[model samples]
Target: MKIKDLFKNKEVTLSFEVFPPKTDDGYEAVEKAAARIAELKPDFMSVTYGAGGGTSKNTGNIAADLQDKYGVPVLAHLTCVSSTRDLVREVVKSYREKGIENIMALRGDIPKEGRIAFDYNHATELIYDIKSLDESFCIGGACYPEGHVECERQSEDIIHLKEKVDAGCDFLTTQMFFDNSTLYQFLYRIREKGIEVPVVPGIMPITNKRQVARSVALSGSTIPQKMKIMVDRFADDPEKLKEAGIIYASDQIIDLISNGVSHIHVYSMNKPDIAEGIMRNLSTIIR
Candidate 1:
């Protein structure tokens, strides 16, 4: 099913993201974790592509399994920064052969060693390439409510975002944000700019202290004072921190839904328990 179709009914939708393991030896473990999350029966599941397409094969395999074994529609990711145009076509072809209909197109993080290839520079270019290969695939692009780390200004980021949507992206999913107000403001700004696709807010539950620095460093998202206080209070207790984190994310989802944001995607990060915790909290609301 195309992800865009999932949003047409104006019904609330929830989805989870899982990533393939870095090495072959860990493939089975990652697959098992993805399966457990699929069993939660989210509206759909997305499998992330590894940095530089290192785990592209496993990404295809896991996405196929989720769609075939668990009967979950899968959105497989494809990153273009480190890849040649030929490689992008090959991956898109493999996804089609696997019965995957949706793709999250990304430019991916630049390797610490610097960019290895230069076939694509921006995500908009990748979006164009994907559409040229298969117009049937539903493409989702990433947005940042608090602005992307590389882009200095949110307005400039939105301008780039408009190019993606204009190129052929069916919808947009945001980088995770701690404050709902941030998303509200972003939505207003984007709508004013004339980019009107359904934007799904991505929520990452901060279950551990380590995730804070890494997520912020990667996303450039602001850590609101309320979130800071919660982390400080429960950072020491593993179980308490986990529980608090789930509740915090659930509250964010509830607020989004109440304010008419119909679709929410969780950066579940292959943890079935965290995914289950969020689902259990919203059993009645999502249904």
Candidate 2:
């Protein structure tokens, strides 16, 4: 199923994001994790690419397996950070040939060891390139609700976003955010600038105490004090912390759905229990 179709239904849609393993030794375990998440029947699943080609083939294969063998729609992620124009073209061709129809175009983070390999600096450039290659693809781009940490200014960030939409991005998915008010505020700002595309909210469950700092540094997202207190209260007890994290994520999803934000995605982190537990908790509300 094309993600655009899923977005058109406008019902509360839930999806999962996973990455392919880097080596054969971990392949079976990764596939099992993918299968376990697939069993939950998320609206769709996304498999991420690597800065290295070792995982590039796995990205395509896992996407094909989930979509063809498991009877679920899959989106393969492609990045320009470490790929040339022809290389990216081949990856897009591979996905199309495999019957995968959706793609997440990104200018992925360059490796810490060196500079970017591609000419493109932003995801919008990749979106345009992908559009030229296959007009059939339902391309998705990433948005930062709190402004891209690297960009420095939110207004400057939206200007680039406008360019992306103009370049033919079908939809936009936000980088994971914690507070509902942050998203609501972002929506208001984006609408003010005429960015009316469906911005699917990304939610990450706080499964560990250390995760707070790790997430903040990775996505440059802020963790609210209230959530910090929750984590601190349950910090010493692993079981309690995990439970609290799930509830926090559930509460975040519930609030989004209640506020008429129909499209929601969970960064499941390839953990079957986290994904299943979240789905089970939201079953009644989602139904």
TM-score of each: 0.99, 0.97
Q: Any runs in candidate 2 off by more than 4 Å, and if so which?
A: none
Output the lDDT of residue 162, model 1: 94
Clashing residue pairs found in predicted model 1: none
- The alpha-carbon RMSD values of the candidates against the true structure, listed in the order shown, are 0.8, 1.2
**How many clashes in candidate 2?**
0
- Candidate 1: segments with Cα more than 4 A from true spot: none
Query: 164-188 in candidate 1: lDDT tens per residue?
Result: 9999989999999999999999999
- Cα lDDT of model 2 by residue, 58-172, tens digit: 9999999999878988888888878878888889899999999999888888778886475777888889899899898998888999998788889999999989988887788
